[model samples]
Target: MGLVRLVVILIIAWLIYSTTRRWLASLDQKWDQKKSGRSEKIETMVSCAYCGLHVPQNEALQAQGKYYCSSEHQKRAESS
Candidate 1:
């Protein structure tokens, strides 16, 4: 009877350990996927021709075949 009880306890412990390990592994994979997905998004970097400041291409102003960080920079570059 004692041996049977020990066997049952060991089986239960193994099942719990296995389940927890799988759950943690899955969670880790999900986190990695999210991080990799974010890293996969590539953005073009541009430098402000006037101030030489770096900015994302999407946020920069386009003028005269050059990129500016703002309208002020654009105006300054155009004037110069």
Candidate 2:
């Protein structure tokens, strides 16, 4: 009886340890993916043609083979 109880306890302990380890590893993978996504977002930025300012690609104005922070800057660059 004593041996059977010890074996059961050890099996339960091993199961708990394995489950916790897998959970932690999954959380770590999610964190790494989130960090890489943030880096990609930073890398997707564009520089303004008029003043060399960095702006997000979605917000920057694209025209005439150049990027600008605003439409006014795009017109200025085109006029000049």
Best by lDDT: 2
lDDT per residue for candidate 2 within 1-80, as digits (tens), equals 99999999999999999999999999999999999998888789899999899999878999877899998999899999
- C-alpha lDDT of candidate 2 relative to the true structure: 0.94
Name the Cα RMSD for model 1. 4.1
Quantify all predictions' global Cα lDDT against the true fold: 0.89, 0.94
Runs in model 2 lying further than 4 Å from the true structure:
none
Q: How do the predictions measure up, each by TM-score?
A: 0.55, 0.80
**Residue 38 error, candidate 1, Å:** 1.8
For all candidates, the clash counts are 0, 0
